[model samples]
Target chain A: MPKPNRSFDKSLWVFHVNTGSCNGCDIEILAALTPRYDVERFGIKLVGSPRHADALLVTGPVSRDMVDKLKRFYEQVPDPKEVIVVGSCGISGGVFHESYDLAGPVDRIIPVDVYVPGCPPRPEAIIDGVVKAWMKLERLRGENR
Target chain B: MADEIIHFVEIIIGVFLVAVFGMIFGLLTKGIDRKLAAHMQWRVGPPVIQPFLDVKKLFCKENVVPRNAVAWLYNVAPIVCLTSVIAILLYIPMGSIPPILKGYGDVILILYLLTIPSLAMVAGGFASGSPFATVGAQREMVLMMSYEFPLATTIIALGWKISTLYPGEAAFSLTTFTKYPVWNIMGPFGIIGAIILLVVMILVTTGEITKVPFDIAEAETEIAEGVFVEYSGRNLGLFYLADAVKTVVMASLIVALFFPYNLSTYLGSSIHLPSIAWNAIDFLFYLLKLEIVIFFSMTFIRVSVARFKVDQVVKVYWGYLTLAALIALVLIALDILL
Candidate 1:
């Protein structure tokens, strides 16, 4: 495996995934991309396909139905990938905890490198989560080299 | 024998030079296009070197071929697309420099060569075996067939006009286009005809490059990147580069056909620069023209419109644009007879 170098850190094309969250976190994720927030200034783009993504921005708790599909999406992302859990639901199942439709938090299904804690995190918090994503990338670099 | 060997080596060198030029300028233009789009939307964009970073990062990532994919074809498709777009560049005159393969091909040959990249994408889409890719490929073929007619009419109408004026010359050649520009040697009616054809060509170019309104084939929201859904890492990177180069190719085609004037032609007599310096100046001017064409065709129009449906794309191209091209053709025909 090639070292996940500075270029990898600089250009992070993220795929946004919604397991079962309310539309709240999804809208915030979009807000981060709007002109006011403009995550693209930092080369953090929201792409449609996982194959073209370097990171996954996951919202919502892992529901029963989404567990298998979420796993497939995680696998589809090319390797040297990071997962950023964007809302409290994805990190701890939030309001959906122990519910019949739930499959637990995102961490159980895939390794999550960063977390933004909010019922539906602010766009600012999501941007911070992306910055925190680089710390995980740095740690990976240290482990590899 | 020695002279022939040397000539062959020069052609090889020129081909490499053209490829390098296309890749560098293509990426730069894409970055600029992105930045301009950001500003148009009132946002601060990524750095101009953003594309370079993306391509470098992509190369370092793992290449994933889906389980159902024809791995060989999936991999070969991007390579074919990139090389074919570069091959088309070899036939287009750059700045004051004539085409590398000047006599080997002409406008008619380039018209055929232009389809190759899209065709390669279609083949790759089918080979990927994804349902989305298949639908995208079908849309791409539909879009391809729709645009080719207006594109051909524009080229043929101009070529016919030139053939009449320059009797016995290679009217369909890019060299001929530069020398006997369609914008020149035309009366008021022909000029209007040429402008209409220019608009048609620009819109055709928009469809060809698959920007927003015409990007039904790669519609991100509708199809999850459609034909490229299965492609990852280096293969995606190649497609990215090919898209950038194709933008330059289409923009350059517009430049060569309609806006073929160089700055040095007017300034050289007064400035008294060396021949080499004049070539450099003309090259910069050509780049400016390319930027203008790309702005109007790719950036401005793309930012303004929402994506069209599959049928709307066909209707716009076949019903409206083809009609516009025919009107221009009739005007040019009238200019000749009058």
Candidate 2:
């Protein structure tokens, strides 16, 4: 395959998914889009459909009931896409790590390009995580050639 | 025979130029609308070239056809939608240039052409075979029916006054409106009627273009991008371009009908500049007018209001707006008789 073009790097439309976690990270994700943070300055938009997305911004730990749905959502996103696992719950199942119904630490279910670990990462930190995903995209472009 | 051949060639070239102009200016207006909306919210928006970058990026991505879709119809609809919008531009004059196929079409023809794009979208949504798209398509059809009555009434009211004023001419030709602007031809009562019609027309424009408060068919939060739920890559890009061009068409139609006065006609002789310079000046002024119309009708309205439910959309257009249009029609008739 030829190198992935960098044209999409500037306008990254993200699809946010909640995989059975507390609403903390989801609120922060919305906060990142508010006037104060305004990630649109860097061309980051939260699109409603996965088919239109360039990156998947997943929140919450994967629970038993959400495992299949999360995988289905990942499959729906088209190629040349990246995944950003947001919130500590998605990274290590957070406080739910010891629960019997826990099935996550998102990397085990899907390939994750960036991990934004916090009980609920601050809006600025979420923006930083998106930048990290862009860096990974650049590195992948380098390797493809 | 020779004259006919030359005319045919001129039309072909005119169509090409109009298509190109529509795409460029349409996208530029969309960029401006976004920036103005963002600023209104106290945020620094994406760069003005953001829409261009987005179209480019979309073209490079994969085109995905869903398994259940009617593949041929799904693929063909975007082309039809975009082409029909360009066709409407051919009938309506732009700035100082006469419409490409001027005598071949009129206001009624332009009205019919305007609906083709939305109908194509409805077809595409139904062909996609997605439940969300099916519901979106139904709402789009309902909205189209609701708005067409007032829109047709506004055009007919203007045409009626023109016919009464000049008995033997082509009353419905768009050129006639530019020639005898409705504001100049009527009595005091008629002017009030025209203003009410103008307000009605602006509100109809809101529904025609499907911006916020009127965009129930594509309510992203409720329907997941609604009619566009299944589109991806180049197909989505085409729909985006169609939308931008349609905005230009709607704004230009409003300008041509109510505010046809040109700066050059007023200031051309005073400045003593060449004719070409005057034309350029008029075109620039027309663009400024278009931007202002789009900002007030689309951008400001979109930012300030939330989406209405599909039922509420139907009620607003059919009930209140249609009644307002009828009252304006009656007032104009009274102005003519009394």
Least accurate 10 contiguous residues by lDDT in model 1 chain B = B262-271
Best lDDT among the predictions, by candidate number? 1
What DockQ does predicted model 2 obtain? 0.66
lDDT of 2 at B273: 85
Predicted complex 1: CAPRI docking category: high
**Count of backbone collisions in candidate 2:** 0
Which segments of candidate 1 are over 4 A away from where they belong? none
Model 2 docking category:
medium
Candidate 2 lDDT, A1-145, residue by residue in tens? 2245766777899999999879999999999999999999888889988888889999988988988888988887877788999999999989898889888578999999999989899999999999998898889878876
The complex in candidate 1 yields a DockQ of 0.84
Off by over 4 Å in 2: A1-4
TM-score of B-chain for each predicted structure, in order: 0.99, 0.98
TM per candidate: 0.99, 0.97
Task: Point to the candidate with the largest TM-score.
Answer: 1
